[model samples]
Target: MSQSVHMSVLLDEVLTALGDIKDKLVVDGTFGAGGYTRAFLEHGARVIGFDRDARVKPYVDAVSAEFPDSFQWINRPFSEMAEGLADVGVEAVDAVVLDIGVSSMQLDEAERGFSFMRDGPLDMRMSIDGRSAADIVNEDSAEDIAHVIWLYGEERKSRGIAAAIVRRRAEQKFERTLDLAEVVERALGGRRGAPVHPATRTFQGLRIAVNDELGELERALEVSEAVIKTGGVLAVVTFHSLEDRIVKNFFAERCGKLPSGSRYAPEVKAANDPTYELVTHKAQGPSDAELARNPRSRSAKLRAGRRTAAATWSEQTVSGKPSTNKVRS
Candidate 1:
């Protein structure tokens, strides 16, 4: 049998924030390969694991048989978790943990089309329901293609890469992962001396676009805050700066810092009482040892918040709602 894939970044810290899980119902929002689920079960936590990828259900099923009545796995996006669990009459949860982004299993499987190192179909949909990356690459207008690459991948040479893609597709459409990777490599003049692959950012961009990852993540955060009970722990392990920023801002706004120039003046009505108590004032990153074990973890950032005992629905509790300043449309 193949060795189990390791989860990237802050795996230990995430579980720690969850507290003793004995009999406490928790939601493993990402459910990618069940790494967090396994740990939660071992700690005697009752878990409802959710993943958009139906393939994970088999593994979850196996675990359920081993620990009957302790685990429930749902093959659907975490965004729908609230409703999925409601069928069984679960209204609120004790904790919700979301490890966002692609899993090691997705990248390792050559047929999954998530990695450039392994040749696969250009499909990058995590749910298998949305349009594939291949569709975007071969059919999107140059401007649209460039926008996805630049906005999601942060690739500086997005225009050049998009132009090359359009030129190549005119002859033959992109059918495989490496086919697009090669074009990105050539346009970027190759990574020659760099340890990272030249196409890393391009692939990241494509996957984000195909999955609409950021938008989903933002929604999940909001929904989680609403559904989790007061004193619940909300932990998120993000693999990129963009993901980290959203988590950071969400918690900061919930904590409700005073507006500038208000320390001496009568407090401006304290807009909203704090919901989550910031667990770590700043975000946490992987340790050096972890970095050595998994280079993919280098970019990972973990931010955690504990729902205050007085926590309330973010918008309902607060008089006004905070705006989600998304970088992309």
Candidate 2:
């Protein structure tokens, strides 16, 4: 039997925040399953969807056949959206939406190696052109693996997990999801009275490392700011704390609130002026109704901001420095 997959995240919230784009151009940065793209089209907007996965090719073909030129699909990473858009003569868009991180479609497919629940080959590359999770697990050093699992996955038991994986791989190479999961489970036992699986964090860590997910997401955020026109909306749906931190900090820095310390110190003035006007004061998540329908929506967080008319994308600085935040620790 095969696993059933559904996109259990902030679908409606993302669409609502995007609001009215009739006859205007919009960019779907993630373009997984065509959810946001479809909504934009329904609003009478023209869309250019971007995805690194060649697996998306067929879906793109199907949608293009139905909508014709109203929707253009670009088979490229969101980080490269800037370059790809230029080739197509697209200078600016009315809005940009990015649903970051792995998708249910990728995980449910056993061959893709995203889910630790199912036994499958450890290959979690979003694009077919890169090195896979299998490659990293079977080859990376313990220190590197621990760092990735710790920083990207935020797994507290990273050292134990990495040591276990290294020891096991020395006996035999890790080839499948269950093979690695079992090692991690053996290394880090379940929490007291907790129901979460032990392998979850390790799997997430491996996937993020294999795909360079955070690095690409940060670059995409920068590129989106560059191409979205003034008054344009930028909505991002993040599934993890690391991603939420990036989104939170991005909005704060752009709105000139980056230097503020909560209940600790006075606000330090930013060296430069603000660029984006925050649309939401705090991050919004799935509504109670949506959460009832899809449990996965529980972890989803959506942050949105509107580009100021006088703002140039380059004008926004994160931490009073350029927006380069990658923690390999």
Query: Model 1, 1-329: lDDT tens per residue?
Result: 12255463587878777777788889999887777887888898899889999877667767778778888888778878778778778878888999989988889878889999999999988887979999999999999999998999888999999999999999999999999999999998888898889898889999999998999898888778767777778999998777887888778777765444556774333466676788777888888988888888888888888876444545544636543222101
lDDT by candidate, in order shown: 0.82, 0.81
Q: Considering summed lDDT, which 10 consecutive residues are worst modelled in model 1?
A: 320-329
Model 1, residue 257: distance off in Å is: 3.2
Q: Which residues of candidate 2, in runs, are more than 4 Å off?
A: 1-5, 190-193, 313-329
Clash counts for all predictions: 0, 0
Stretches off by above 4 angstroms in model 1 are: 1-3, 258-270, 309-329
Model 2, 1-329: lDDT tens per residue?
11124453776777677777899888998877776777688779999999998886766776778789799988899999889899899888888888989887788789899998888888998988778888888888999999989998889989888898889888999898988887888788644565778888888888898889889988988887778777788999999999999888888877767656575977665555555788777889888988777787788999998876544435434344434212100
The alpha-carbon RMSD values of the candidates against the true structure, listed in the order shown, are 5.4, 5.3
Predicted structure with the largest lDDT when compared to the true one = 1
